[model samples]
Target: MSETHVPARRVVVIGGGISGLAAAHRLVDGGAQVTLLEASGRLGGKLYAGQIAGVAVDLGAESMLARRPEAVNLARAVGLADRLCLPAASAAGLYTRGALRPMPTGHVMGVPGDVAPLAACGVLSDAGLTRIGRDAELPRDELGEDVGIGTYVAARLGREVVDRLVEPLLGGVYAGDAYQISMRAAVPQLYEAARAERSLTEGVRAIQRRAAAGPAAGGPVFMGIDGGVGGLPLAVADAVRAGGGDIRTHAPVRRLARTGSGWSVVTEDGTALTADAVVVALPAPAAASLLAADAPGAAAELGTVEYASMALVTMAFRRAEVAGLPNSRGFLVPSVDGLTIKAATFSSHKWGWVAQGDPELFVLRTSVGRYGDEADLERDDPELVARSLADLHTTVGLTARPVATRVERWDGGLPQYPVGHLDRVARVREQVAGLPGLRVCGAVYDGVGIPACVATAHTAADELLGLLATVPAA
Candidate 1:
């Protein structure tokens, strides 16, 4: 039998975030020469970790949903399965109306399956409850176009659900204004459920029925690595390097030009690298800036994708300081409550392994979103940290001041999938498809999660490899 010869193809991947790293790893595994360029000195874009009181704390994404298989599969492939850890389930509180109260039971992201807990829990008034109950009889919109999550929820579930429950819960995830986020992009399943069942409650019931028949329904709600969420990025980087990819930090790509044969990528150091293919896995704004001249229409559509800034403040406290705190994960702050912090995650309670069973050490991570209020995000780190601690004290009766604090600011970290995001993204995709040997993959296009980014990168890599295979041998 004759041997099939495959020519080597050089590929350049811009950005060193999870998406970019995943793309580089996938390309390298597919027998391509990969060079990953990161603007910063580190590989992980938003995934950062620092030591606090001798404990490693993740300042970026705290955990991953086990039901999302992409991240877990990537980790397992990279030999990081042993590092995985599950958090202990605990009650989550909600800071609303100048007090902290327990979140209603059977409430999935503020869309309640059962209204009894919300009514009995007093998260909303009798009038608010009545308004929510009216959603069952609310007419469904047959237009089927994408709508703002807040608008849809408010119109159907009432203002209380949007302002108190949805805003705090979903807002924390995207660091976006609920009224501005796309209902289809942010929570497509919710929209699907609504479409299938007519009522939000009934839709949730259907999902519950499906989940009950699945394996994850009885498992832990969230999972993380023993070291921290940072481990995921590190594992990805290791996989990329092991697969013969060149990962370079502090190497910012200045511009990308279409060469006769392929693409020429010029870096900040004034060096040009010609590659058979290029994968741009940066934020939409950065990607647009790099691709404007070559792919003008795509760049324009990419520019329409908006992003919001955020900061994560991790405070470490002594266990004795927060004596009466419940053994629960964390609490969210409703916008109606006029709270400065968006949400607080009990790092110690959520992931017991992260704390190494140190009863005296309690780690709390509070998030500040820059959606409607960039001013709040502009506050000094110390002031923001102080405010978060005070709110924690008021909400959970934690009197202990943090013994150590770490603050991480992510400027334009989360991309907001607005009402027309899907259309714009579709247009961007069409524009990119017009150019050969070029691809753009990232959270801005599909989803803004570790799993989604990895999956998108894998798909992009597969497409690029298929393109390489079609090329004649030199």
Candidate 2:
């Protein structure tokens, strides 16, 4: 007797960023015939690998949060297990109050479980420290629906805490203003704690205690690849191709429309492609544009999402020319300090691979601009480098001129999660779910971190696989 046969699903993933690449990788693994379409000549989006001064470095994101298994698991699956490494010097500092101070521990996104350590670290003034202690006595804030992380923390711990500690830490992740970023969408764990506990400090303590007792307790907080985190998407793309998936670059998609049985994808050059299912993995704005035709509701919701722009100034200096470098990874400059550079990473100190790649040179990078503060990004690359150097000299006493410099500007690179962002995402998802054989995933929905994007992509792929299983072979 002949046996029943199940056909492989054909899935087309739009966008070549890490999220899109990860989705394509998972779809291929699930026995799907996948095709990944990228708008530009490259993949990786924010996870870009490049060289400066003949030394390899991640021009974009450098590491992934290791506590989540998605990113590390994907890396290992793509043959990067042996290349995983941790920061050589993990301890970081915050440049605040006219000095660089140790980043206080026992805090969740700058909200302290205990203020004593913050005082010891000199991250806050005596008055600021005293203000944080008042959280225990203050009445519970209603926090109706949702609230900005900064607004809630400031209401309880005082504005100084938000400006000095919270702003810079959150800035490093979102490149956004803390006062405008959503507590629920950006930091949901803290948001849950806020809803359950009356005092914000107690809420933070509960979170830390739960984390200590969780599965990932005492593990390395962040992880990097021996080469650079930017290589992740390239490796995933290779894996996808090895699985017989078609990957295309310089193929900007112009239109997406649902067909009678499947979906039709039209490229800007008028190349038409068809697929059994489709994953919309572009950034919010691009995703909105593509979904505007068939999934107008989802597109309208996505249109509300905003983005932030920033630039990274990567520099390499001769080791002999540098003196008195901080004995830590790097320092974050608070916006309140009125510094042009928001944060600086001593790449040579943070990643052993960077230092080993070239012992004679010291490498570092500075991030300039954030959400509403992007005027500095308009300056020429040389001027941006000079401003970064000026701040470095002021903060760390480093006055050496760089041997080589590369400026990477990320315009509308990060999505902003304002209040009601989660609700907006839910609405978009609900609207898209109404259409069969369609799913969406990216930093705009779940999170901006590498792990979160990978996880979201996996979810989209799995959902599409399940939906495809129900359809008859064409």
Q: Best candidate, TM-score-wise?
A: 2
The TM-score values for the models, in the order shown, are 0.95, 0.98
Cα-based lDDT at residue 52, candidate 1: 82
Q: Give per-residue CA lDDT, model 1, range 3-62, as digits (tens).
A: 222248889999899899888878877888889999989878777666788887787987
Clash tally, candidates in order: 0, 0
* Cand. 1 TM to true fold: 0.95
Per-residue accuracy of model 2 over 206-290 as CA lDDT, tens digit each: 9999999999999999999999999999999999999889999999999999997999999999999988899999999999999
- Runs in model 2 deviating more than 4 A are 1-6
Top lDDT prediction, candidate number? 2
Over all chains combined, what TM-score does candidate 2 have?
0.98
lDDT per model vs. reference: 0.82, 0.92
Clashing pairs in 1: none
